[model samples]
Target: MEVVIGLLAVLVLFFAAGYFIRKNIYREVDRLEARKIEIMNRSLADEMARVKELKMTGQAEELFEKWRQEWDEIITSQLPEVEELLFDAEDHADKYRFKKSKEVLKHIERMLDAAEQNIEQIIEEIYELVTSEERNSSEIEEVREKFKKAKKTLLAHSHTFGNAHAKLETALYEVYEALKLFESETESGNYLAAREILTKQTAVLEQLCAQIEVIPALLSDCQTVIPNQLSEIKDGYEEMASQGYFLGHIQIQSETERISGSLSLFQEKISLLETEGIHESLQEIHESIETMYDLLEKEVHAHHYVLAETLKTESALQELHAEKLISKEETDAVKLSYHLSEEETSRLRHIDKQISSLQKRYTHIQDKMANEKIAYSLLKDELIELEKQMSDVKAEHAEYREMLHALRKEELTAREQLSEARTLLSEAARLVSKSNIPGLPAVYTELLSDAKRSVSQVSEKLNELPLDMVAVNVLLEDAVSASAKVREQTEDMIEQVYYVEKIIQYGNRFRSRDENLSRELSEAEKLFRHYEYESSLKKAATAIETVEPGSFEKIGSLVEEDLEELKNK
Candidate 1:
């Protein structure tokens, strides 16, 4: 019984599996049928109707027939094959042949794809033909209008185009012929051919319009403007030549002839409509003419400059000559009193030589100007250089004059300083004599003697023939320093002596009470008698300060007051 039940369950499962397999195969068959119907429904017919609306002959008619035939083949042969495959797939699924049904469905899907591609290709070809026809019809009208306008402009401005008018007319004729060909091809239904012709003619018309626009100005420059300028330049050249203005470097005649030849050649090229390099050639000719004009104008300007600057330069030369003479006289006068260095004398001689050389240059320029053959531009440059040299010479002359003045000032300063030093030494001597400090130390005496000698040396130097002020100033500085030292030392020594005396006398009061004070005061007296006042003052002040606490400072103040009073007296 268990075996039968297992066999029954097994049969149930086999039927259930077959049912599911059949259902899936039916689903696939339905999907492929739907794809085939969609492929059949593409709008290729409407696009074909568009193609038929155009002029259908020649290439257009032939393309239209080919596309229509391809569409017919897809609808009749390809789609029916897909429908047959769909039916076969449905039959296989109904009989429980799932594998065979899948194979048939796959075949139907492939057929549908091929038919869809064929329909798309036919529709695309028809659309392309229709669009080309429409574009050719519209664009040809525009191209014709452009050609008409361009030809009209060329006719209106034939004079402005100069000799290029004939060649330009020929180019317009070619464009007109191309327009005719486009119309002929369009009428014959070869729109693609018409489009090619229209494209080429449109470019030609645009180029011709541009050429017409600029040719007038360029021709006017070449024919009238440049020739008039050349004529004016030649006339100016003749006028200036007669007026004694040297204008030979310009080569005006040959250059004008060459430019005339170029203008003629340019006219020929323009007649043939070969305007590629003519614009640049005309520009070069204009620049050449401008350069000639500039050269002539420079001569005119330079002639006026030469006339005015020549007189100014001559006056400056005369002034410089007078200054040089004055410098020589002053140098001679100073030579008798002050010794001048060799470099100083040589500098004056160098100035003289420079002035002499400049004078020669001035003469040469005058001679050149008198001949009226040399270009004034060259003369102007020479005169400018001469004026600059004169300016430099004037600067040197001013500097040398200041140097001579400084020499005299320095000599006078040295003498004044010497006199002041002598007076300072005398004051120092008078201070020593009045101080009554028993005698000065040996070093102080030697310094005083040296101060006197320094003063004497400065005076002797000042008195020497061709007085070397350099040496005199040096001696004067030494005398000033020596005299100041003597005066400072004399005052310091005299104050020290007074301080020592006052301190010793003031310490005597403490001597009776402090034996050490008495002994130190005796030693201080000995130092004072020996002119060792500074040492004596320190010894005495130390003893008194030890006994009286602040006696040294009190005595120093009193001594300072007494010395101030004496100096005033």
Candidate 2:
């Protein structure tokens, strides 16, 4: 019981020590956390001051607000956990203090990172705003005016709105900037800068002028379709006038004025169309106007009147086709008569007969040539097969000869070994007999006796050798004679094969000549049938030259002479 009381007292002291230690650790952690909060607040305030100084607005302001809210959330949610960790670490007297300090340093680093990001965002926003303000102050008014004018004009003309407005706005902005820069330069007394600005302003004005000039061209293209509905006779004069399609040099100004006059008239006619009720004719007019408008748009884009004028002229030409210059039946009759002229018909009949004859001859020659080719090919194949068979036979004979030679060499070697063995045995027996040693090994003595016996047995075996050696000699002689005979047969067979090959080669050459000659003869006959006497004679001569039998003979003789010369060498 005394020991138990003593243990309880020790536990109470331990509990008191733990309580004091935890309290001190908590106080330290709280202090560190307060310091961390102070640093974070100061960092955030610095960033906010920078943003305010930069005067961030629009999307930038929204982003900054979001960043601030995020910062608040992180501090609120994560700070408690950090404080608890610090408190827990303070109780441990290990490396926990260094570790907790490092954690706090990490939080400091994150805060710094957030501050840097905020500052960078503010700087970008400030830069953008400055640039936008500079641009707005200089060019916004002129650009707005141009955009408004373009929009109104496009709407009035029933033209495309978006693209024209965009173009106009862009051009006007450029002009506005140029003029504003000029004014600014003048106020600053910088003549060179003013001159540069003026040059750029001139270019912008020219571009705008060019764009405006296209408008009337666009209207002109729209007016061209008005002439399509008129009769060909009525439209033709106007079309030619518009296109300067007259025979001679006319004043371009006068032509232009005349075309403009016609266009005015056509416009007046089209204006009448608007007042007409919505009948089929009105629908047609609407479609035509739309088409003309599209053409005009294209013409404006291309900056050319040729395409629009060409379209108008083509429409006028289509209208002129209403008058039948020639009846369909008369045209058909004329075409038939043209095709069937009497002289042409006779010539055609003659050509047909000649062609039929030539075709028959060609087919006959082709068939004959084909047969000759087949026969030659067959002979060539036979020659190849025969050569292959001869090669196989020669290879087999060579293998057999090699085997016989090896067997003969083996037999000779065996005879030599037997003779040497006998000589060695004789020497061994003499040596044993002359030895003076009395107590010699019995094994040595028996060895001497065995050597002598072996010599005697070998001699007896040699004496009793079979007559196969004589038979071998006879067989060898017979084999040599047979090989000679085979050689002669092979030579004869080779000569026969070569002769057959030569025949096939000659036949091929002959068939080739025959085919060429037949073609020439057919050509000559065709020319003769056509009454082309000179050409017919030339073709006949060519045929004769191509197939000359003397040529083949000469070639054959030359080949034979070369073969003989090779043999002699």
Candidate 3:
């Protein structure tokens, strides 16, 4: 019983010590939790003060909001959790405090990192908004400049920026409506309709930007700066659109909603801007528009001058080409004429001279025929007396022929001589027939035929008549006289035939001349119509000179003078 009392007393003492140790550990945990809460509250207060300061100083509101939200998350949501962890660590101080502290510190670090990220996001957003706003304003100025340059007068109703702005606002409204429709379509699970609406919105926005470009103040407002800025915006928008950022994707939709809200706020602010300053702003826009107009007008005038110069040069070149063609035509005509053989040309000229001589002879003969007064009775008496003398001579020749026949056996040599004389007459007649006589009054062929007939008749008459040597000699003399008469007639016929041939050849020559002159004249006229006046005149002169030298000199001189005048003009 004494051992049991001793063991029981020892157990009681151990229980008391354990109870105090548990109580002390709970108290220490509670204290640490309170201290952690105090630290968290202090950090929250500091963060809140920073946000308030930023708001009061008109710092970026987005930045201030982001910082405030971070402070709330730390103080309201994470601070209590951190306090619980600290209390748990105190209860296990020998083993848990070090590891638990590390965990708590890690949580705190994460919160701080989140806060920094929020601040950074806010700053980036502010920077982007400010840069975009500046670029948009510059584009507006460029549009104003383009408007001024495109029209003649800023005061003109068609040239006014007010009209352009109205059109731009209408387009913007259309885009807004399209975007709203796209949202509605996406919400209703109509992806195709949503895509179509988005496409339409994009097109409308593009049109708005294009129209803004026409307004000089918006497109090139600052001649040196704004175009580049507008280019960047256009490029950025294109890039974003290409990446499907403007469609109703989750992230893009959220961003677009935020931008739309911001745009609404901006519109409200613009509406509240003083109405009294609007007239001055419009006046400035008008001035920019006028400057743009002047530049465009100058460009137009310069273009007109350049076009006129080009036309003048073309006209001159055409004239020169026409002149060259005319010159070529003239050369061809001359070459054609040169192709005529010299022998043929000379023959034609000789024929012409012969015809002139024959014409003179014919005129002489005609004049003689007209002037002569002849007595036909006296010519008949002379013919009768000559016939009686011829009859007596014939009787004497017949007696001589009979005497020669009686002495034929001894007079063979005399008969042969007589035959030889007869043969000489026949040869003379043939020579006369072959002779080329000019200016004969009868046809050569008819005269030769008549002479042959006379010879045949005389040969028959001689055969019938008997004659001695003396009578035969007399007959031969008469035959010689008759042959001379036939020869004279043949000569006259040859002259007449020659005259006819000469006249025909002369006529042919003149016809050729007329044809050549006519052809040359036709060619000259063609050249003139083609505006080759100088070359045409040269050909005309050459043609006239060929027919009648110095005849076309006056016309050629006039044409040359006119050409000089044209040059001066």
Candidate 4:
């Protein structure tokens, strides 16, 4: 009886377990299908938004068709197959085949997963297809408005517009035609093609508008402003010429004729409403007028400059001429000693020639003023030009005279330098003699020889005919340099010899304390005997320092005192 009751309890537990298992399996299937339906709904909404935004319904239709195929497969194949399998699994579970039911549920889950993946991928592909086709509606309208503005400018300035702007007219007509074509294309959903056409047309229309707007200004300038400027330039030329400006270099007649020709051509072009290169020609004409005015103003300035400079030049030339008449003899003798350079010689000849020519011109002008009633207006420039030449000649003469003065000054300087150099040479030799001769380097002898040779060379330069004072000065510098070297070497040798003697004398004190000190002192003495005062001083000082540590400095101070006393003596 206990065994029977236990079996009944086991059957009730098994039935409850089966019922719970079947319910969980159905719930899992429902959950997977709900997830797929949710994804499909969200993806469809996304596709719809993409289609509306991009106006790319072609790809949206393809995606929707593929989705429909997938969905139909899911409903017909996956759903029904899974449902039939679930029934078989249910039958197996009813017969206690829970394993088969689980396997069937797994199969349903896999199909649902694959279907969800395919739907997600299809959604992405449709999204990719339509993503970049973002449409802007006003692109063509913007270009059309630009064309209209350009056309408005053309119509408003139709009368003043250059008749030869047929290209502009053709462009306008083309714009109009293209606008119609754009409208048609736009209504037909060809926005991209219409946008491209509108972009190119807008650029063309903008360029045409720019050209059209400048037409009236160009016409008015060429017709009135530049012509008035030409008149002003002509009057300026005549006015300046009346003021005695030498307009000889300025081809007034030819330029006036050229201006007339340009004006006539411009009038003909204006009559024809010519446009090609018209603005360039207008600017060229304007520049020509300005250039003419510039040239006329320059002439006016030159005329005034000549008038003012003429009086200055005449007065200066007269003063210089008088001075030259007086100083001629004085300068001639001064000039005889001068060694002029090539440039100076040529300048002198030029000055003389210019002075003679100017005087001749002055005399001729004075004669013309006396007899032919020559206007001072004309003679002013010519006479001023001659006077200018004379003034330059006088200035050139002054430069040449200054050059002569420089040479004489150089000669005097050379003499003074030579004397100074001789004194240095004597002092250098005396100083060397006072030093220990055997202790001197051979280089000192060579330096003394160089000094003597330099002094002799400078003295010879002083005796030369042209007296190349510059050469004498150069030799004096060399002598001073050489003498200075001899002086330095001799002085340095004397100082070292004295220092060596003091060090050696001081080193003797330490020689009794150390055998090496005695040996070092002997070696220093041998070097001193050989006239190597610098090395001897070093060795002796080192030897002394080895014994007394600061003995060399004390010795140097004592030797300096002794040398100072000798100098006082």
lDDT (C-alpha, whole model) for all candidates = 0.86, 0.46, 0.46, 0.68
Candidate 1 vs candidate 3: the TM-score winner is 1
Q: Which stretches of candidate 1 lie over 4 Å from their true place?
A: 1-61, 64-145, 187-189, 548-556
Model 4, range 1-569, lDDT digits (tens) per residue? 99999999999998899899877776765675566556444435556555455443344455556666775676567656655665665676666777887787788678767877876776766555443233325455566676778777767777665553555678789888977876665554454555566667767777666666776687677567876876777787777666545566667678767867876676566545455686777677667667777766665555466456656755666786676554465445655664445675566556656666776777676676465344344666676577656757777788767776787888888778778777776765665555544655566667778888987887887787655555667777887787677767766777788888788776776677789999998998898888787888888887788788987777778878866664454
Residues 315-360 of candidate 1 have per-residue lDDT tens digits of 9999999999999999999999889999888889999999999999
Say which prediction, candidate 1 or candidate 4, comes out ahead on lDDT: 1
TM-score of each: 0.80, 0.22, 0.19, 0.44
Query: What does candidate 3 score on TM?
Result: 0.19
User: Which scores better on TM-score, 3 or 4?
Assistant: 4
Q: Indicate the residue-level lDDT of 568 in model 2.
A: 50
Error of 4 at 504 (Å): 0.6
RMSD of each: 6.4, 37.8, 43.1, 15.5
Reference-based lDDT, residue 306, model 3 = 36
Candidate 2 residues 1-569, lDDT tens each?
99999999999997777676556655655666676566455445654555444335544355457667766655665555555555555645243354464455456446545644654565565454344435444554564465457545644654422234445555566676777776665444343445556656656565564555453343344344434433332344346445433312223335345444555644344333321222344345446445434433342333234333334433432332221122223334433322223542343334334334433533443354344432222333333443354344335434433533454464565456555555554443333334221233343445545555544544443344331343334433433343333334333332323333343344444555477666665676565455444455555544454666454344446556644553454
lDDT of 3: 0.46
Compared with the true structure, what per-residue lDDT tens digits does model 3 show for residues 419-515? 5545654654554445432222334445545545555544443444232334444555555555566655543333333332332332344446598
The candidates, ranked best first by lDDT, are 1, 4, 2, 3
Instruction: Using TM-score, give the best candidate's number.
Output: 1
Ranking by TM-score: 1, 4, 2, 3
